[model samples]
Target: MRQTLSNPPSGKKTIKQRFLKLLPCCRSDSTSPIIQNSVDDDFELSTVCYRPEGLDKLMQVTKFDKRELQILYRSFKSECPSGAVDEETFKLIYSQFFPQGDSSNYAHFLFEAFDKQKNGAVSFDDFVTSLSIILRGSVTDRLSWAFNLYDLNKDGCITKEEMTSIIKSIYDMMGTYTYPCIRDDAPKEHVESFFQKMDMNKDGVVTMEEFLASCQKDENIMQSMHLFENIL
Candidate 1:
């Protein structure tokens, strides 16, 4: 049976309700009914089609045309029954692909990048914008997005601890694949190597400048930018 957007799973809260729940923590006057109305306004705004100028800009920026964008939006909304996907839902959806290990941390980082609003939930606009960049944006755009994810503290720098944690999450997600199992320290070694190569200032922290300069110079980084695009 085909499910329309109107027919979300029974007993589950609607996406609007979920957004309301998210609003309280984000605002100073969360208890006010006016705040609830503001949330309602924002939710309505997010679901609207892009204006003609905006659509034209999107076509210019991304590979998706109008028809393609419509199709993708439908699929994205259907998968997310609530009309928006929170981090936990995003993590669960991604973890299924790995089938061997915990991908919670990687999904966490990926979701952070996707939540362009930084409001703890991904709107349709957020999903499309981030996806377009990952699939077809320029090298500089992709690298900048990645650095944002690695900069967990949002302090404009990537720390060794943050890099190690993300790398460890990725390795954990990889699990024991093939005949030769990966050692526990493999992620640590990988982090060390990455920092050794990219940390140009020897300050133990990588600024965005260093990340971009190093990534732009690396043949491997340039080659690997589109690796995930094929899967999409």
Candidate 2:
């Protein structure tokens, strides 16, 4: 049976539930107390009401409407009472959704992707902007973001080493959940396959142009994109 976010099996919070905990509008009240109290005491949810400014500007740039933005802001404030999330806290929250695996490396990369300013923190705006792209942006936009995630150095191109690292991190994050039990050399093999199609110029690295063209032209990849729509 397809599990619903509101009723995760075994009372363990699914990735979707952990994700929803960062967006109040869709959150359920049945969250496990163990999970609810997992946040550090120093960063506990505060009773203070935080009103995020620049709703007009955010709406213009992202896909969220005014009401949705407000709801997101509330959720952000609840999790990050200080209006920003540091990398450590971000990793903690992300790790919760993948207890069966070591999500630290993956979380590190994801945190860097969301930390647009490279300021060592993710503000409410930064959070929503990326969330908007992942959950609602156009295919090109989403692909661009995914490319950025893989481009660890922010060097505008993804090398085999970079892709390998990302694939390995993903494997580590999926742990035993990966069907058929991925082989030890799975990450290397995965990178080789990606490079075969993505590095169209035989340049040993995939540029943004190449990545976009390759993915956009692939019917299977386009269809698979929908599987991640609920990941926010």
Candidate 3:
């Protein structure tokens, strides 16, 4: 993807728009509950969130078959002892976590993720850049938790629909966690509402053109990567 913004200062922000750094968060820190929430356990979604390296570890080691359940079990052991799934659980239930289904869907998901312009097609860098965003928090917080949050359907890969919903959840979550830094309000809603209208061509889609037209930031992308830089 382009390392630079889509358009220059000579432009606008698209529709009702809203808009990672990582930390080696210690196992425990008690400044505030949200900060404290940074702690990890296997079952907790926070623990599941992971960056590129971690995702690579996950994809590399994870079994494509029944072995998935075992890993889930370990996560539960680390994070939640009370509500773990039993050995008798079916594979389909676990399937819910794999948000992207087959190869085609994975391709689509990757396309959206890496498509810097949002026109939908994977780029080498945008696809890889999210690693920085993913690595911004504890393993659980970045992967499982982020996954769980974005995977509204409980499926593993975040779909375009899921992405739309999550864009909102992302803001709400940020406001909640960084209440002091950023006031609590519907910033995500602002962004989404704008995007909906910016579907100006009525294509039922929003483009990077529409997006760039809308934000004040020099770089109007999701800016998730900043978390890694900011935290550091």
The numbered model that scores best in TM-score is: 2
Top candidate, metric lDDT: 2
In model 3, the runs with Cα more than 4 Å from the true position are: 1-164, 174-185, 188-190, 193-202, 206-222, 225-232
Compared with the true structure, model 1 gives a TM-score of: 0.71
Q: Runs in model 2 with CA error above 4 Å?
A: 1-17, 24-53, 223-232
lDDT of 3 by residue, 108-142 (tens): 33234434455433332332344333433443334
lDDT of 1 by residue, 72-180 (tens): 5545656875768999888887776555678788788878878888899998778777766765578888788778878998999988899888767766665555224
The per-prediction tally of clashing pairs is 0, 0, 51
Which lDDT value does model 1 have at 56? 77
Better of 1 and 2 by lDDT: 2
TM-score of each: 0.71, 0.80, 0.25
| Model 2 lDDT at residue 188 | 85
Query: Per-residue lDDT for 226 in model 2?
Result: 38
Off by over 4 Å in 1: 1-63, 178-180, 221-232
Candidate 1 minimal-lDDT segment of 10 residues: 1-10
lDDT of 2 by residue, 1-232 (tens): 0122123335454575568665754444655332255444214334324345577889898887765676677768778888899999989988878787888998899899999999999998898899888867788999899889889998999999998887788678766664556688877876887888788989899999998998899975555433334333
- Give lDDT per model, in order: 0.66, 0.74, 0.34
